[model samples]
Target: MTDDAVPDLRASDADRERVAEILRDALAEGRLDMAEFEERLDATYQARTYGELAPITRDLPAGNGVAVPPVSLHKEPAPTEGWAGRIVGGEGSSTGAVAVMSGFQRKGRWTVPRKFTCFAFWGGGEIDLREADFADREVEINCIAIMGGMEVIVPPGVEVVVRGVGIMGGFDHREEGVPGDPGAPRVVVTGFAFWGGVGVERKETWAQRQRLKEERQRLKEERRREKLEREAGRRELDGSRHDLLGDLHGRHDPHRERRRGDTA
Candidate 1:
């Protein structure tokens, strides 16, 4: 049958398996969270026709086309490059920021010093490290805020240690202790806040996240091809065995008839 004619046909076990693989890839790439993945996975197995299976992964990258590919659950995540390039080990491009009654931001492709300090009084400041290089393996950021606020943003796969003290104020340390990438710098956040707040957040760069999604899709396609090859091999082996057995029976039957006739 033509490829275009198969959608209305009853979905086989293989069809359901393909859809399930696409869902698995989506979940791994963070396109879908656990709860959404579970719901779609259940629906995929319950689907009875190609039309039903097609919609399960229709919106996902893996299922953008008509075909749904298989993905290896055991595959390891792709590694980000070593941190040597990110650690310049020199003077910081900009040492710190101060906002007495305004706002200051230190971001972009700047160098972060080994010991960086920032203070905000009746104002606010922002420190972003998503694309910044580190001056040392271990960097300390000291922040002092009195009746003002500050925010620190770090990317995924970086160690963060928050040791800020807040008196009648708030210091965020929710992302502490998360494992970091190999050779990535360790960030120590130390600060004091009085009637003010300091917030720490973790985020991934948009480009990095997109690369991960594409990698997952590629792996899924490879696994699907492997599965199809395996199934084809099994079918060919079964056909050969059947033919061998039939040939043996045909040769024995003629001899048995001759023996019976001679005895009679």
Candidate 2:
């Protein structure tokens, strides 16, 4: 009979571990992504009955000598994977942006041209290229900060080159020198900052960081709950063992039998 046939039966730690192993194997074979694997893993540990655990691996093949489907090894990598999808070469979304006394911001699904010129005079500006597409493989950003500062944000895996000259201010060279991933775009920041500064930074998109943070928190909380449950189970088992031993000793006591004979 299958586990589902006895769905109401209590599940042991062994049963849960078996299901967890299946999930892990599925993840190793690329059948499950990280998010799905972690979700199923959490469910496996939280399961208290056979019913709860069965659904976690309902579609997966049973492990332990069972023949699994053959994994394909000759599949070509998807063009949409990694940097290939990100480098969309075309005309830039916008040519130039200038901030006089207020501020200018360029972010969110915009395209960067080969030479993007931005000037900030007495007002700060921010250029975020984290989620932006590129018009070319190698593009240049010209920053002119006369009396206001400018900040340029690029995503990880991008190659940054800072060649801007700042008479009284300076351009940030911290993000430079790192080799970019294959097919990834290269960004060059060049221009002058007379009395203002230009800063470059590498950061992931906000949504990506938030998703990762939530996943970590979920895993942490699950671990804490599992720990508490284990401790409680151990205490219960110890108490049961102690009570059983006491009953056995009372039954086998010679003094109790002798007292019964005296009464007779």
On TM-score, the candidate that comes out on top is 2
Candidate 2, pairs of clashing residues: none
lDDT of 1 by residue, 1-264 (tens): 555555545454566667777887777677987678768876675554566677788788764565543323344223335567899898998788899999999988899999889999999999999999999999998999999999999976678999999999988999896666656799999989999999999876666556445745675686678679989999999999999999898778978889989999
Instruction: State the local distance difference test value for candidate 2.
Output: 0.78
Deviation (Å) of 107 in candidate 1: 0.9
TM-score of each: 0.54, 0.64
- Clashing residue pairs, candidate 1? none
Residue-by-residue lDDT tens digits, candidate 2, 61-163: 7765432222223442232245677678888998889999989999988999988999999998999998898888899999999999999999866889999
Model 1: residues with Cα > 4 Å off, grouped in runs: 1-21, 24-80, 209-264
Local distance difference test values of all predictions, in order: 0.79, 0.78
What 10-residue stretch in candidate 2 is worst by lDDT?
Answer: 68-77
